[model samples]
Target: MKPNAAATAAALHYTIVPKDLAGHIFEVTLQIAAPAADGQVVSLPAWIPGSYLVRDFARHIVQIRASSGGKKLALKKLDKHSWQAAPCRAELTLTYQVYAWDLSVRAAHLDASHAFFNGSSVFLRAHGQEDQAHVLEILRPANVAGKSWRVATSLPELKAKRYGFGSYVAADYDELIDHPVECGDFLLATFEAHGVPHDFVINGKVPNLDIDRIVADLKPICEAQIALFEPRTKTAPMQRYVFMTMVVGDGYGGLEHRASTALICNRNDLPLTHQSEMSDGYRSFLGLCSHEYFHTWNVKRIKPAVFVDYDLRLENYTSLLWVFEGFTSYYDDLMLVRSGVIDEAAYFKLLAKTINTVTRGSGRFKQTVAESSFDAWTKYYRQDENSPNAIVSYYTKGSLVALALDLLLRTESAGKKSLDDVMRALWQKYGRDFYTRSTARQGLGEHEIAALIQGATGVDVARFLAKYVYGTADVPLAQLYAGFGMALDGAQASKASLGVKASRDAGDCKLAYVYEGRAAHLAGLSAQDVLIAINGLRVTAADVADGLHSAVGRYRIGETVELHAFRRDELLVVRAKLQADDMPALSFTVLEQAALLRPSWKKTTRR
Candidate 1:
């Protein structure tokens, strides 16, 4: 008979304290239940999942030591993140100090006012004892006294209040590391989704925040996702969920977890106390939230095969980000419309924005989505100024692939089968019993997609995947949009261009990125060039865009114009002819949209 997980598990206890708040250091003490007969080896993870690349977390360890049975044991460093201790018969104890300074969703950060950390940044995994239960004790900061400080996290409480300084428990090492903790004088609010409690914890200053609006806007989204996965029961997989946001002057992104998400957004992106109209920034923030929340099912649980058991020591490569991240990107904004927060017209506009962004870059023709996903660690995460000219984003183009598949499935099955069906099929087949039973720890592989789609929907999508996902062929958007009573109005009028993306910098127009094979590239106009004149006319950054466009306004295609710019302190002049560029500007309008009501899928593009 198998030993019970709760009863047979050895407990690993950890005590954490804000040792030096001004210096941003955390003092940690880990008590091991037992030590190895041989010397025990402990290692910190080289990287965290969801975000690719090796972070070398152990580099933050400032000091470390090991002891057992009240006697200090000799500790030796074994490589980067691993440490070995001499043989000990009694329970072992390890103490360390970590320097916390990174202020992003990926790592740990601490200041005099606030403290936050991910388990990957502080906890060291005990080799060969990963399945044992782990417990953490959060102590009140020694430096600060009576500051109304509170702890917020999704980790289960043992002898702690909901948001107090005390003990928390995790099923194992993996579960323990998945929940990030934030302690500060935060703004806290609570709401219930399908009777499950969700805590909203904000760590920055947003003046007169409209908490009701946030609760109202996010509640429907949470409920809809719950109903999507567990339709009959209307239940969520998590017992509790937390949305931990850090508001700043200007920042935006998020990272997902099992039952919680960490987000960073600009202060202006938050809705005010009585704001009626939705600003573009607020919409973008909502999209970011939706994207990360969708990962609760897509990437966090329904993971790529290689990620089922993450090998944190190295890069875990998979070509299925088109399904993991791409599909979630496609649904992030679409769910807003379906959930009644946004309208269909607004959704179509959002879709057009994505389409324009993807097509504007020249790299879509050079790199496939699969290649982009595979090289994400080296290329996407470490992008530079020439990124658009060399590589494509799996997130952007991958969403288009998902859109194409949704259209294909809906059209082929007469509106009876949509991407919704495919997702439900994915959950039922692979994700339903994932955490409930350890034996069914399965993830989707690259070779399994075509067969799975065919088996679930009785439609063969091998050619579709080959043309768009694995190959660099663009999806037939114009043809597909027409099938839904939408007209793709490709722009005929062109805008005057230097074939470069420039921004106003220090009263001068600076080229941010010069497209390859464009007029700017041919004229030797490099990125970082500051434009001062066009055809002997003075120009400043504020008016350079209009000035340069007006300077070449009268010139037709194939016409040449002179330009002056400074690359660093040196000045140069170059002449280049205008080229007819197919600006990726598509406008979607209503054609037979009058009949938007009661539309059928058994319709082809208006040929």
Candidate 2:
């Protein structure tokens, strides 16, 4: 396609009108100049970035019509996803209406109440013209007042009553399509810290939020992020950053970007009332805020080489999601501790919860962190009933791996080296210095990570990664903890065990493994028979432990108990002798409490 200076100007003049009402219908009219060539096609994307599935965005488009110079032009459906313009050289106006009832974050929706648009769902992706700049002039319904219309976008808002894009260029179409825009009567707030401006574009009503307190609480999070980049780059990339959010209506998630993030959260998630002080939700929300903000360095800039330039049409597989997302997940809470927003005890509680949840899942035995990261597109993103049985979460496993690695590095170097050093090294080498040059666009390679560890800690991490990360073997936590002069004190837990190594199977959860002399074995419970009820409570293996807790030693040793179960779909009853299973359990303790085992600014807890 040749550069058409005039066409570029015409593209900027495009406008959209919203006739939102009680009915689930909204129309879009695209004003385009028809080229001389026939069979030129306009198409919608099958999927958007951040979301790793092919959701045909064009399916929602109904009743498409094309006209030229006030005269109806013949249009044909060239394919299921595209429409062709007739042979003519005239001003072409294309119009279409979409079914907007599903009020999801990924698609478009409009009703008498409100409207939501995820860019790719409503805006036509003008092919061949991506090189040129375009502007969107929104014409709100006449009955709608300015107060009834608010706009949200990651793109800087132009003062000319329109949103403009100067050469819609990115590493790939994935980045381009992921940018979104929202319109409605929503609240907006602005705050600044560390000389960087921030915007909070809230869609819908405002909660009883205390603006000053919220900002004050966020200062540390923002400062920690600023500090992370300052030593490496000395400056923030953009003068202004935005957070386009949908406040509180049954959905919550965020998609990160270079200068902004699009988030969907519940209004209750935002602390506005005194009741918020009593709930843990506020802390979780702050953790979320810190997590995404930290991404400004970890992921948005220092990304995996595979993700540096995305392939929007398919999965971009990499064995580093644990490094990217898992590390981020670990830091989300750690940032709270480092930022003074959360205490050390609270941080450990979060870690303990993470361990309990991740370790309890049987998938850890089936998938390694490296494999989990690589298979995110197929297994992680598209979760199913068999997910727990066959897959470990990279986010969960990777964070644990990061924790182990951090402890290993710190102890090996006598507290002289830490994960922070590794992050700073990467930031300095790749994010700050290398990302600016054209030649540097090749992106960070695997060797870069290996080299950083050797230079920073003088430790050979290759074998550790190859074994624990790349293979489906249980992580050597005992060895890693020993390095930190600590030992897992679960010797008591394993002593008391039920006959069952409770686990889910074939989507139909049940206790699959039973050991002889265990309490469950003495209780007359056997393997391969469908576990119908435990202590008269009908539940899966996940619920049996909780049921046991409420028993209060009701089923003691030598007590005859009624065990109801199903054998191959046939319900049966049996009696068995109940006895306690003696097994040692796992817990955390310091082998030799070190005085230096504390955060940079925190008081020492060593005795």
Candidate 3:
């Protein structure tokens, strides 16, 4: 477990500067203390961890060259993302310019206002010396516009002060890229959760930003998650944490990191100083934060076995995303209620919405959650028009699976056990001290979950896993809810539907998706078909608001109508018999008398 003396001494040195803010370019220099005797290969990662897609980050390099002892060394492109430098005994220096225009969390982005980048998008890996200590020096931009810019990253400081640009250090290459850097004159707030300091940094402007309310609401959520993993100690895994968010006009996404998270949210989602009521947007933003915060323990550490050692050059596939993402989805909302941020009524509404989303898509009938998790790289990420008909989402359906498993665990164990126990067990065995321990890190295996569940909760879930996870059977939510002092109800739509999702596109009713075997699909309607009219009545873009609600809702079930639509340039007329909406409108109601006896259904006070 002792550190290698040579590797420790010969740290990989890197320097990055915002060379041209107007042109959105970053100049990066890598200094290898000792070059290999044979040709030393250097390459940028093809993808970032947490995000499953292979993004081929090297394509962003505008130009790259190598040098040793002030003389140019030969650099040859070996592959799409790798380059080989001629053997040199002197310290090898590789300089490159990265085009950082991507405005997402996964890649680098730069402009006059701000600069942000993931290390994966800017730093190239020195192949043979990846395990060596890595030091990063962030140089201030020469332009006057960046004079006030401040650096924000979770990377441990070497010569740099917190939030000030100078130098940072990482134990190895993996640790180097795990922390993303954000440089801007951003708004900042600080809060303490169970003795750990957490920073909330906002990059964009808001009219009357309410920093106190956000910190108050998020503090409990963070503390609850910490307690969930380490209930007895109530200790967080990180020394310090950061919530680095970029506020935009309209955006909502987050990618988790070990001690920090990169997030993007709508500016309107932030609370105003005068605003006292919780808006849906604000609740959603809080939920987003909770979701990513939970990942500090879940996927970020208790990872799938394959993710333990990531091969950034290609997709690292795993069939347990359901457990990682789906369970996180289930807990994201639940934590809101547990932290006293939202009430039971609001929690139930969110739960119902998730159920509706899963049931509305017919893809669940064809594909299981396991298959959905396995094919996430190809099917989930690269979805198209037929996605609703072909693939299921491990996120939505996996949450349902987690819900069902939790309910079943509580029921079978006579309320003595729950999914919380299993999660804590996973943390104890796989997550807790994952980074601090000197032994080889082990991730959760593909087929080890069922056994772990039984061992932790004393409940056999083989049949449950087989039916819902491996097989395409829907979770028996109604039956599960009945036992938990709740009633699940669905309202059947009375009006006839084309079973097509439509949107207003260019002053016309554009059919976005026609569900398979539905009235529209049976009438030969396809996606992207422009609906012209129905029964001699003109259909405009207004009629398609909320998915053809006005145009199609007027007709009753079993009614026949003449539909005219354009499949590209060809006009088609077809008489179709409308069918009742198959989409489930689900809701849950708490049975008062029965709920009194159920501890699982009862709400608890915030710690």
Task: Please report the candidate that would top lDDT against the real structure.
Answer: 3
Off by over 4 Å in 1: 1-9, 504-508, 537-559, 579-583, 592-607
User: What digit string (tens of lDDT, one per residue) describes model 3 on residues 460-493?
Assistant: 9999999999999999999987887789998968
Give the TM-scores of the predictions, in the order they appear: 0.93, 0.78, 0.96
Which 10-residue window of candidate 3 scores lowest in summed lDDT?
592-601
The clash count for each model shown is: 0, 20, 0
Ranking of predictions according to lDDT: 3, 1, 2
lDDT of 2 by residue, 1-607 (tens): 1124564455523455556556656687766664437545677766665555667778888788888889988888866667788877877777887667655556776755456666567666555554344555555554545345755555534343332322232332333454566666766667776778777766766557655555667777776767755744446655567767666666677766666676676666676745435246667777777777777777777877876766543567787888878888887888777677776556666776676667655677878888887788789888764466578888878888788778777777767777777777767666764335666454457446667776877877887777778876666666777755566554423222344555555534355655455555656666666666655766554455553333324455556556676667887776666545432244566555422234442236533
| True lDDT of residue 219, candidate 3 | 97
Evaluated against the true structure, the overall lDDT of model 2 is 0.63
For candidate 1, lDDT tens digit of each residue in 1-607? Answer: 1224563356888999888888989999998878787888899999888888789999999999999999999999999999999999899999999999988898899887788999999999888888888889999897644268999999988889989999888877898899999998989888998999988889988888987788788887787777777878987878899999999998988999998999999999999987888888888888888888889888888878888898877899998888988999998887776676776677778888899889888888898999999988998888877888888889999999998888788778767777777888888877777777758598998789898898878889999999999899889978876677778777864655667777778788888888888888998898889877777877665465553566555567788878899988999989977766545778788765312212234443432
